[model samples]
Target: MPKIARINGPRAAFLRRFLPLLLDFDKGDKPTGQVTNEKRKEFYDCTTRALVLCFGYENTLGNDSPGDLWDTTYDEIPAANKMPKLPEPESIERDTVIKALTPVVHTWYKNRRTEANSPAGRAVLTQRQVERTVQAFAPLAPPPKALDVYQREFKQDYIDAFAALWAKKLEAAGTDEDALKVLKRQKGGKERAFAAMRWDQESDLKKKEVVQRCKDVYADVVKRHKSLWGSPHDALPNSRMWSAISFHRRSA
Candidate 1:
């Protein structure tokens, strides 16, 4: 708060210039200026993701929960009686997956937190022979609304097959044998997300180190083996050393 109060502070001018606009933009009769509503929304999504990653990327890399930090920070705000009160956002927890087998690898930490903290409320049902009286969300249209809440029913045997399938994936986890070649293909697209920036830098450095190591090893072997086999014009390449070179290149 003192830092914010300081007139010469780095962000003081920024806050002063933008704070009123930020507070007022959520009000009625808003002017979006040259930007269209769709463009504003598109930029909002990208900006929100970028800012969130900036705020939480290091904590995420260190295996901490950003959501917990958000809650803790919110609780520490000083209260003023005349301050505008912002109502909490409306949220309705939907039902969890049924008898389907859940993959631990694919499960997101956020969804796990939601599942643990928020229970699905009882859905209002029909009194008679279930003519679908209870559509949980009143604002939602009837059927064909692209149900993200639930999956289409699958046979028990088909769901059971995923166990064996993922078990094969577990066996192939670190090997070059990616099931869909996705891991290998995505390597061409260098990591662009801010969330993985540190990891991406480390990975790139490791690749350069590996390439340098390979070059050094190649040079050392050529110099030493040249002493044994004489000039390349006088002698053919050694079969065993060439085989080893091939093996090392594939491993790299």
Candidate 2:
């Protein structure tokens, strides 16, 4: 059976919002990214780790509990058996919450682009930074613009979307029924449990993992930017700054 990879909660939340935006390249092990290959791996690993941690896996069990996942330090190097998986929302209702927040993800990336290219020494945000910002919007009341629906309504709608999409993907992939059983897990309480588990888990260990993930992702971000825009300009302004200005100018 094909196993789902695991990730930390914040990264999982970010994926719930922006996964639809990623083009299904159907090529490499990792999703395609504008960043460097190493950065892409960092993105994939960090996001998967976030999902796994958030989804209440035994590996991430709370410190107070006998499971005590905190005892095991977070390591970027995967053990032969360790696989980072995102705990997918199981039902239409839960999936709705995931889908409803998609816009927040888009807005985050757009905002990051603006910041990275800012004329001044604005914060050169990395993908990790952007994911953190988007994750902050979870449980937020549905904004009154394009997504002008009640929170309940949005969650339901998101669930429906996720169900439909999962069915299609599973069918296309020719996956086994048992392999997809994980998708059937009840979502509402499970999602909350996953979050609480992280809270009860050791704070120090969690902090260390988060920082390491961020650093790895940051290195990738730098590689990606350099690859895309060529080396930063020798003079005061960098290529990213110039690119940002041009992007805004074109949009304006």
Tell me the TM-score of each prediction against the true structure: 0.16, 0.23
Off by over 4 Å in 2: 1-80, 85-189, 231-252
User: Model 1: per-residue lDDT, tens digit, 1-252?
Assistant: 011111222222211222222323334365455444444343333322222222232222222223211211122222222111111220010001110101211132223223433443112111111211121112332222111111111112122343344445546665656543664344213221221333244455644554555455445545443444344345323323343454588999
Question: Given candidate 1, what's the lDDT at residue 178?
Answer: 58
Per residue, candidate 2 scores C-alpha lDDT tens digits across 1-252 of 112323324433334443322322224465344544455344344434433333333322121122112112233323313432233533233234333333433344435434545664144334444544343333432212212111111233244444455566567647667655554444334433443444345367654554455455446545443444443364212344445665688999
- C-alpha lDDT of all candidate models, in order: 0.28, 0.38
Question: Total clashing residue pairs per candidate?
Answer: 0, 21
TM-score of 1: 0.16
lDDT of 1: 0.28
With a 3 Å backbone cut-off (N, CA, C), the pairs that clash in candidate 1 are none
Alpha-carbon runs more than 4 Å astray in model 1: 1-39, 51-64, 67-252
